[model samples]
Target: MPNLLSRGLFNLFFGSKRKAFEKLPGPTPGVLGTLGDFIGPNPWDVCARYGREYGGVTLIWMGPSPGLVLNDPAVIEEILLTRRLEFEKGNIGTQIRPTVGDTVFIANQGEDWSAKIKVEPMAQPWAAAWLAALVGPLQAAINESVDALLKEPSIDLTPTLRRLTFDGFAVAAIGEKTPDSVFEDFMLLAKGADARLQAKLPLRFVSFPEGFEAAKERFYGYFTERVRRARAALNPSAVDLMSWTLREMPTVSDAWLGHILGTLFYGGVFSTSTTLVGAFHQLQKYPAAEERLAAEAATLAGAPLTFEWLRGAPWSEAVAYEVLRILPAVRIFLRTPAADTELAGVKLPAGSTLMVSNQHLHRDPSHWKDPETFEPSRWLNGGTARDPAGSGYFFPFGRGPRECVGAPFALLFLQTALATIAARVKVHVDSTEPFEEGFFFGVVLPKGVTGRLIARPSQAASLPGSVHPSAAVKTA
Candidate 1:
């Protein structure tokens, strides 16, 4: 990374002078202006504001880096898919490489990214099996937390869900139950690393990077232990994610696996939690969905959620997609121009950084019918995909060769968790703990800053064969 500016310095000093500008596809800018508000209301606000003025491909100068803000689906698609070779994952990838090693998010273009995304099965047959395996454990975990909530009557779903996600990932990925300290390890490491990078935090003073190193060691020890246990136990029927990870191990190194797991967990737990939290927030604003979902779940009294049920649950999927569309867990996805190229016809010089803001594109009116309205029905036709090939439109799991590798796993996990909880209890937001809306180490998360959330009971009932925990929930 130190070599980045060094190589570009020559271009900066004596390169061809081309006046750069953002050619926004739309009109009417928001409050987020380059000269007006450097620090906009939120990351989304910044992109929304800039996107309105500059259109499809805008420019965001965050500190020293010049970011090409790609907020349209067409342009984003072209960059990510049509002309993907011309782009690598930009700044965030390099910054996180030191910590995450190099997997998908941290991997530059070419063999590394291709290899990572390839091992995972495409979005089809495995989707059913994957979600089926996940639904069983995920439901139990949600039930464990929700049943405990009955003791107090309410709790913030954010942190509780984070723990559940960690447990699910640990069990699914390595076929092992993670220690409580591991959760602490992730929160500490992810938050610490995010704070350091975002605020330009220095590591030398307090050994921040070393602390991350220690966390990595602990996580790696666990990863190695679990994989060995899974491989040695080799009951083909007992296979889980360890089998999947191991299958791809030959092409990848232990260090790569460690960082991938770490980054995957950070990404999985944080993004799912954020989207769920956002879902609850959206639900609160409109309580009708809560009643409808509960009522529907109640009707399937004798029918436990089979893989078929998940497929048939179009309304649930619609709501989930709507929540993501309105409030995408990740706002900014950065891609570096590997070589000089014209994006949306703007001649972005080689080595230029592109900051694609899904946040603004999510709210774009041209592609969407009612941009601000949280109408899940819009997604009933599929997604907010005005153009399937366009990248600037909507990509919760991203797209192309460098898109999210674990998307199938994540979708399964999230769907099961949401279904189980929504079926059993209603999440009522009772606090004003603001969700920190910013990019954190290549993913998005609720601000890890301090605050408590409150939740209360509802009239939701259990489906067939679903286990209700006999113990009370404990709040720490």
Candidate 2:
């Protein structure tokens, strides 16, 4: 029968993946071997638990394929920093290719070489400048959410915060304001895209929810027009990311522009929103940490949120770092050896898939004192800041040249957004329902968690200034 033929083919393909790294220990096998480990409802948590039980280096399954996961920091560092040149993006790149296209984030080492060279340099400096410039609009977006929460008896804060991040990033990155309908459609498409990628199926073969493709096309058209407008404009002071890309990277194509914009939006909605929600949940669980953060935030009650202010707030930064440490938005990162290599004494042939579990590495007992505890004070010693691109023990955004380009902006946004909200309101977790785990795309998010916001007594009014609207140019 056709079913038997399919099963035989699946086993044949999966068997080779298992044979490549057969020396490693992993989850207990079922009738179909490692296939059961990944076909469950919450694969990320299941894999993280396996990493904990099977020592730092374990072989796991991504559907039928075997993936080698590294939780040891030295091995992680070697693969991510020192021996980075010997690896490529691997399955993660393949998973995200349909959604992100072939830009720097998902581009293989030698394939999209030219586009990588031209586009990679623009992300970092522009991230730094963009963070400093967009505080007003960012704050305005945050304030709207905060104000709306003030009016609600009890509301789903996840969607509200997610929307604010998307709107803020749309203005900051794409140079246009996304209407609610468009934003909704885009998010739906993004979720569908993420589902397809996570399923590791060919996108063309999968059926998406209604309107997913249309929403995707609309965003493409929108970005294409923005590029055209930027080209036609003569303004030297334009501040959005599109203007910077057009001005500095003149030869970049409209397709590349759209890819970059799509990556930014995807990150803004998915990673940043999840991190903030988790931070808020932690604050609710630990009032002392919240009070300490608010006290630190109170120091700049009415001061305009600037890069300097964000950098200077030690407690705010600490809380953010602690949240990231405990509940990293990006749980797993992938790589494969570009050449035959040995990792932690095991020989890995070229093209062997390797996964780094941020969740396991972060909570590894060797890295911290009582790693499970939610103690923000641990990060505040001697004014050390947690880099999203790991220093040694942490890697929320990962490390090396291939680390997230949006990291600088993401950190600043977290500090500013957290401080901006904490300064004015005290958030209490609505504990009627217990916290549950959220599996979205491939990352973990806060589920069943809600908060009640109360005005902090004697707090100063919101910093004065309306958010600057979309313009060809604005003061940076």
Candidate 3:
């Protein structure tokens, strides 16, 4: 095997650079090297098992490259919080840059990025205020979609939910509903960019997917048109991101504004859709958990679906935590050492790749009880019993400056979605076999996740806008 010999020679010659990591315990790379770990039928499972099989720190080969996987929470905290400035988002962030632009999600640590950090604080209050304002419209949209879907025997909910989230963005940001096809096209472009990133090499070259350029052009075109429309609005309101940015930063260029909005759009839609699909899949597998969530939702009968109502639902929050913990949309967070550093007494040379698998860290037995099992109760008391982002144990939206700026918005969206769906209808997995989790270009996907939706009898008398019911009741 000339390929094997060449790799062997490469490792043999430069292996000394990895000596410190080599001393750490991990799965022995098979003949295929670490490619065997990532390119297998289920790479995430291999990563999870590695956390169980190895020590706090494990070194794995990504073909000829070496990476240190941190399963220790302290080590995770050190990188995401204390030493955040030292490490950048690395290749994955780079891969996503052209798609998301230079928003907080992909911005590196630099003076240029300092102004970007303002987005979180600025968006925090803005999101809260706008969420309250958009609650009625959002409820209408979600209820309409649910009512339409309930008539079907079985359905795939990802697209519907993605549209619901996009509508929320529309009401808050763009002031109109976006076509479902737009979201679909955006996903393709993002995945294409991810593929392009994976195919990148030092000397080799590869072409992008055939339709990527067209999709990218269309994606940017939509934003350009929307930004133009926002600028042209006679009496612009501060409710949407574009309006707010234009009002607050009058001097910023239109291109920069488009990039900011595009980043938010991708982050919001991708995280919410993938998360909802995973949450529903898990609920189908664990009926008791589903029952608990439904029971909680049923309590809100005859009451308005307010922000308070969504936040107060205990089991709803627990389920959100469990779903995000087990099936984080963004799995691997790659960072490179800003300079030569030591982690857990292991030498990490300057620019060494340091990866923290959120899946592994969240599922690490040392931090979570019976990590393999889906136990929503684990998050009951404080909602962070095992994985608290504040403690650096759990960061589904990431941590530090680069942490997801849309996290609070994401939480609000998830709570509203789970509460609304559970309150009106019950979903059951329709397939005979166990649902298989699949990784796509970036997000986690539940392949062929078909489910039956049955409206609860009590729901007929409860919420408005029910297709089965006489008319839509406006909750106030």
What overall lDDT goes with each candidate model?
A: 0.60, 0.70, 0.69
Candidate 3: the clashing residue pairs are 464-473, 465-472
Residue range 1-476, candidate 3, lDDT tens digits: 23667556646766665565666886555344566556645655666667778856777766556668776777878888888888876766656665665566667787656767765434544556766655555666677777777766557766656676777666556566678677777777767666756563631364556787677777777776788777777245545666766776666666666756666677767678888888888887788999999999898664568877775777898898888888778776778887777776777667766767777877777667888677889887776754565455678887776677777778777878788888888766665255676655566666777765666778765545333422211210
RMSD of each: 7.0, 7.4, 5.0
State the displacement of the C-alpha of residue 168, model 3, in Å, after optimal TM-score superposition. 3.6
Q: Which 10-residue window of candidate 2 scores lowest in summed lDDT?
A: 467-476
The superposed Cα distance between candidate 3 and the true structure at residue 345, in angstroms, equals 2.5
Ten contiguous residues minimizing lDDT sum, candidate 1: 26-35
- Model 1 residue runs over 4 Å out of place are 1-37, 60-67, 120-128, 201-210, 244-263, 300-303, 381-392, 431-439, 447-476
Q: Whole-model lDDT, candidate 1?
A: 0.60
Clashing pairs in 2: 86-338
Q: Name the runs in model 3 displaced over 4 angstroms.
A: 1-22, 29-33, 119-125, 200-204, 234-238, 244-254, 299-304, 385-387, 432-434, 459-476
